[model samples]
Target chain A: MARLTLDALRTILVACAGEDDGVDLSGDILDTTFEDLGYDSLALMESAARIEREFGIALDDDDVNEALTPRLLLDLVNGSEVRAA
Target chain B: MSTQSSTAAGASGRRVVVTGLGVTAPGGIGTEHYWKALLTGENGISELSRFDASRYPSRLAGQIDDFEASDHLPGRLLPQTDVSTRYALVAADWALADAGVGPDAGFEDYDLGVVTSTAQGGFDFTHREFHKLWSQGPEYVSVYESFAWFYAVNTGQISIRNTMRGPSAALVGEQAGGLDAIGHACRTVRRGTRLVLTGGVDSALDPWGYASQLAGGLVSTVADPERAYLPFDAEASGHVPGEGGAVLIVEDADSARERGVERIYGEIAGYAATFDPAPGSGRPPALGRAAELALAQAGLTPADVSVVFADGAGAPDLDRAEAEAIGRLFGPHGVPVTAPKALTGRLCAGGGPTDLVAALLALRDQVIPATGRTARVPDAYRLDLVTGQPREAALSTALVLARGRHGFNSAIVLTTHRP
Candidate 1:
């Protein structure tokens, strides 16, 4: 399976929770914390549920919470996919 | 309860008045538009468009067609709230703005509160979550469902948005609960709260909600919008369920005057609620008692009330009971009675507050909007039903009545503010 990319994650974030005005998601944002990127815990939880359903991956609540940045979340999701395979 | 104790508790001599109104009804979105629609007798009931209701027994509804939530609410709130909450938040925004309570208005957070009513919670949000539970397992459900499906979510969200940390509650007595919530808010204001955002807004038109409404056996199954849901007409069958309602900024008269509030809609003179005796017990229904108690609390008589906003249940037995109550209280065809909800079907928890708004508007304009599309009132009912056109009258006081499904009756008396 292909790794989860920042672009795919951005799409999921926008779909699960709406983007804040003036917050550019297309920039170099992988390392930016979700709080700085204007996404809250509820938004992240919604994104995680959507990702789990779409990518056939299981994500623990702790892992989702600990993945503060898009890079960390993508790594956690891809790691879960590899382990499931 | 003794009359003295009840009077002391219910009417503390502290005046509470409605300063601003925000409405999102079937025919219109704002108070002005809704009032215009009501005066012109526009029918908002139509074929249900929220979903395909072809399979349901009742296929028509009073649905708000052009409400785009994204235009009124912020982006982040779009995911966490349901349509009903969206309506309420927007209405609260309009009401607060109308009341001149901007961020710079300098009201203490604890001085403002919110009280609302809802018969069903966010049924659409719950239905979506339940579908995911049945299809993809419970893990797929969104976390937002925790608060979004609650009946009190409207009050919670409004309180958080506006930082109204004072006394807050959510009532649920079906249609009558709307009036009960405002009645409680009146008590809150009398108890020293400066202002309370009180009213009701409801939307349960989803397939699951529709099924439950139909199960009640009171919805009009008529297909045509013109002929369906005729309240008080001789051929009245049943009411069409509707979405949306109204919210008002109820404030202490002294506080409003101190704040330099320019317009006071009317005073919340009196309010009362009663439960009917058990069906077939041979005791009379208690709707008239509720009205009498409200008037007595206001220190007024039945003859002083200029207009009566009837419940207009649309079903034969319920309409007959309401008509007989009105006839007995005000004498046969003695007082002008109207049901502007004939335009927007029964709104459950939303109906009573919306009717209250209509009554206040009538008091403001000094004219009674006609009962929409109900012309052939039975002679036996003996209701001086206002029809055909808005009637010109010297309106001073209005009584709004509402009844929930299982005999919950409530009445509110509004008198023009004196001094």
Candidate 2:
């Protein structure tokens, strides 16, 4: 049982950017636009795979696309936030 | 046999011309953006920041940035295909849009074809599939995994999505495969197909993909981003691998004339391709021979070309051979050689189409940018290397050259359309 930090989330975001720079996964969880940080559908799936392996979490591509962001990623890792959709 | 003065390839059918161009490049994702970035000499190469690239020898590459598959492909098709194929679909859609074709348009009704090429089709998908099969058992693998990794997936997907049934081909991208694909598409018109969607797509950013290049010793492993891949520079180590994939709108010249498509970006005037055999096996005469034959095929002389889009493998020995080949053709002087991918890294199958795009752009602008990362041309080269900033002149024709890493060298001639 390990804890996630802001630094770890940043690393994940940057790594995802390299693999699929087209996805918009950067900003806020609540109001962030889908096109802002480049997470298109395929990118969402690819990122979900990478996240599941890296954080030991099983996230569906649809869920990731719906709530993918730095703040949201941190909240999800800490179990502070629940999947809305 | 009433044909008088026609060859097999030349007399294939109606002449194909480029109507539109769309690209998802590392420097810029789309046409206007990428063309602007290219003209400004932006450096898209950097360390493989996507994964744990720390373990690999060649950590540097021209990685694509800010390009999401969702931005280019439909939502329903998302879960069905691999990243590479997704890239192909998106790029194809963009190209189609650029050409003024609708997404659900009846491309099948028009004699359209799709030909895409790549070296390792879907290494990313295969690598992940293998990992899953090992860890979670065989049942965990997606059914689409097998199709994703195949070489012809891009062409098949593009053809199906567009309903283009003319002729579907997935070239293995032997360097000349991109040129050959376009050439093959052009030939289809003679058999009655009016249009062809021909290009290549490759995204080798995964671990195994990086490792495969490591085995080849063709990548530059230097840590410094600016100094890593200096093609034609004496201090060059090796090339920086990049994400390469693009789609070109090619069609018959007569059809284009009939439709009254005004902007004749460029024409596939003449093409030549050959294999050099193995390296140190006494330099096969195929590339030079191909170049000469390409000139003859285009009904052109070496003097007709205003600039040369070099293969620019970034390998010292190969670069020298390419320079020698160009020198022999155009007389050891200023034919103006340019390699735009030096900044973006080699995209493998993506290389030729992107290069083709650059050649078309160069013809339109009448200026070719210098091969990025090179100020002083290598000692052995005698050809005029366009370096540092873009050069402008009255460009009429361009000779694009490519030599695949797997023993294929191809040259394509493109002529500018004035009227």
The numbered model that scores best in DockQ is 1
Residue by residue across B260-297, what tens digits does model 1's lDDT show? 99999999888999999998999999999999989888
Model 2 in CAPRI terms: which quality?
Answer: incorrect
Q: Which candidate is the best by TM-score?
A: 1
Against the true structure, candidate 2 reaches a TM-score of 0.80
Query: Which candidate number maximizes lDDT?
Result: 1
Report how far off residue B128 is in candidate 1 (Å). Answer: 2.6
CAPRI grade of model 1 = medium
Clashing pairs in 1: none
Task: Please tell me the TM-score of chain B in candidate 2 relative to the true structure's chain B.
Answer: 0.94
Off by over 4 Å in 2: A1-85, B1-9, B103-110, B278-283
Q: After superposition, how far is residue B74 of candidate 2 from its true place, in Å?
A: 1.9
Compose the digit string of candidate 2's lDDT tens values, residues B1-419.
12224432365645668887878778888877777778899999987887988877768888887878766665546555777788778788888777766645434444678877877788888888899899987645655575778988888888878878776677774556777777666666656677788887788788887788778888777888787777777776788888866888887777767766667678786776677666578755577787777677767777878898887887787788888888888876658888888888888878888888888998888889778877778656887888888999778878888778767878787887643
